[model samples]
Target chain A: MHELSLITAMMDLILKDAQSRGIRKITRVELKVGEFSGAYPHALREAFAVASRATPMEEAELVIEEVPAELRCRECGAVFRPSETGWACPSCRSQNVLLQGGLELEIQSYHGRDGDVGQGRSRQGYSSGEQEES
Target chain B: MSVKVVVGKDILAVNRKRAEDLRARFKQMGIKVVNMLSSPGAGKTSILEATIPRLQKVRAAVIEGDVATTRDAERLSHLGIPLVQITTLGACHLDASMVWKALEEMDLSRVDLLFIENVGNLVCPASFDLGENLRVVVLSVAEGTDKPAKYPAAFLSSQVVLINKMDLVPYTDFDLERVLGEVRAMKPDMKTFTMSCRTGEGIDRWAEWLEKWVRESQ
Candidate 1:
């Protein structure tokens, strides 16, 4: 599955960052996968288990947070979760809608042990923008 | 001791950056790039073979992606156009980096339109952006009408949907209205084209629209 490729890419990113921060071994990884990101959490875990072997994340715990898909109506400026059968705005019944969320596929953070002091440390990768809903 | 790192980074950040760079290059060269996606045997190559010749005024090039084999590449070799083929070996989809590498093998200076035929898959390709101006998902009548509902990622991300192999519609249980209805419910603004590559039906309108789009991008 393509989830393997995604997991490999994610591991590369995490390992590179971990190495730079003097992390000897990764203990945990947290990911935010959106409903529309085309990646399933179960598949991701299976991929992670396969991709992390012999790497710093060999024994790491993989945590995934799924985000629900949200749509914003352009005509009515209303934000709501799309119905299973349609994406039309519930408020004004407009078909002019934009996806407001549920397309995210990102690494939120990681837990590791520093090589020198053997102390656990946490690093913030980047700031995510506020997702506003109406 | 366990430490936490805040890595609020998009998983495909590297690929996205490369795609953005490719987009800038395409824009600079005034090339309209169209990325085509579909499942196996969905007539992507057939449609291209029939439509490219009708492009008429537009100068076109193609970068074909396949899991293995260059058969698709050979099919279009008769067009006498610049073509490059990327055989991914085992990768299920083409990332922007692969496309970036393929571009280095071709000359796009005189190309008005560039068609990137992605690996025949509806899933993984939807998640990877190749910096194309338009994304088209090709569905054949044999694939059934429920494809849009089953593979929403591909349908949702695509701007255009081409329902190919209309000649075989009577032989299959494909419901055109149902498929269009589902697509409309998901994406109301999506442009749709129904065509039979064998009979050359509906090819002219698609080719004309494509040519106009290419010219407008220039």
Candidate 2:
């Protein structure tokens, strides 16, 4: 239900960065959403569809990568995926556990059209884009 | 003509930064903040009403969050403590910015314990950080025992869990052991307190623990 607010916050960040970099239109957005991040992927997709309207991302494709929940047992030094019914360590049956993963809610990257470089130039031979990891 | 921009930024980075700033400010002022979360009608207000008076050595303040109501703020007004009411108007949760705005309205010069009663929803609030020293989840017996299993995010994120409404347990099918077991399975070291605000049971223990934390923060 708070997906709309989350989408708005995410759009604020992405659009600001995109605008500063002279990105005229975003084509794809990749987000890493954890299973336990307290946000539903389907809901986020719906929110994105609504929030991205009339913006640079109006026709963008929203890509979500879901991360599974992981727990590490303190006593047994074991790492495992927690069962739906319990979070105890499978190796030692210890309840002392720490959530090692699956709380991520991050925007990994986006594909955007370069506004400065593509000003009515020849559109041929520019299908593949260069990769930049920050 | 297309380029990939690698952001790798957290979605809630703005809220997280605000919460961190508030945390630093609270630490400088020697204030221990307790953020309370629970479902609707889970005795959050009643627990506050019962526990506030028992904080004999601590000067407490409250920030009440609701979708749209001043009643909770009014309930604690007779306690004579500095209180601020934040009506979200329709928001399901209170983020850090809202809390920062609320803090501007209060004077925390002599306050030792600050309680922020978040809006009544277990899901969205768990994702928000309000710069509180402790996160307390109040689960009443009337809410049923499967709450921990159903709402693992809240139970896992909270450091303390208060099982309220002990008096109503006999009438309901609330299994105390099952709830505690599930809670422990998620967080083994979660500090839990079973109390009844109506009957005044276990209030002293809860209040003393809170006062101790507040005094230790100072």
Candidate 3:
């Protein structure tokens, strides 16, 4: 499935960020996956474990946030959450609503050890890359 | 061990970027490009065979992508249009790099419409953008009606869905209504047309759409 390839891409991005910031370990990697993004979260989790082995994210916790599908009504310009049945604008009852978001598959943050401060700034502390714990 | 974290997002982002570049190039040349995606045996080739004759005045070109065999390319070549075959050598989809290569080798200076027939796989091709303005997906009635639900990625990504092989609907127990419903459920606004490329019924509607697209693009 395409999820295997997506997992590899995610890992590559993680590795680049860690190397650039000089972060020693990644305790958690927070991600937001949209409901209509065509990505299976369970399959991605399993694939992430295998692909991240031996990397700094090996012991990293993956926090997957499932973003519901949303649509912005073309008529009223109101944003509404899409239900499982269909996408409809709640404000104006318009079917001409364009997609507004929720298809996000982004690595919001990575937490573990904070990287060294740059540009002679004070240390940002452990919360620098802090992800939402719960 | 410092964890260098990067978020590449979709694995096909680079491919998409390349496709966009190709799109810009096509626009500069004033060409109407259509990216065709579908499952195997959806009569994609047959649709092409039926379409080329209708577009004789438009001067179209085709770029065929497949894992192996030049059969599709050969068939398109027989139609007397410039055709190039890009063999992925086992890859499930055609990426932008392959299309770039095909564009370089083909004499498309006079070509008004470029039809890029992608490798016949419902899953992977949806993720990759081939730099075409319009994406057409063909679904044969011989396949189950549940295909749209099962393969939402392709249907959702496509602008038009051609329900092919309508002639077989009578002989088989395929539910045309359910299939159309499923497709509409996934993409509520997608333009769909039911046709038999074999019998040449409803080919004119598809051709008219293509012609309108070309005229508008120009």
lDDT (Cα, tens digit) per residue for candidate 3, span A1-134: 55666777666766665655566677877778776666778978998888888977798888888887777878799977766445556666666666667556676666656555242332234333432222
Residue B76 alpha-carbon offset, candidate 3, angstroms: 2.2
For candidate 1, lDDT tens digit of each residue in B17-62? Answer: 8899999999988888999999999999999999999988899999
List candidate 2 stretches off by more than 4 Å.
A75-79, A117-134
Ranking by DockQ: 2, 1, 3
For candidate 3, report its TM-score: 0.77
Lowest summed lDDT window (length 10), candidate 2 chain A: A121-130
> Cα deviation in Å at residue B98, candidate 3?
3.3
Error of 1 at A35 (Å): 2.9
Q: How would you encode candidate 2's per-residue C-alpha lDDT over A95-130 as one tens digit per residue?
A: 888887888889888888855534434223333223
- Looking at model 1 chain B, which ten-residue stretch has the lowest summed lDDT? B1-10
Please report how far candidate 3 places residue A49 from its true position, in Å.
Answer: 5.1
Using all chains and alpha carbons, the TM-scores for the candidates as numbered come to 0.89, 0.91, 0.77
Each candidate's DockQ: 0.40, 0.44, 0.18
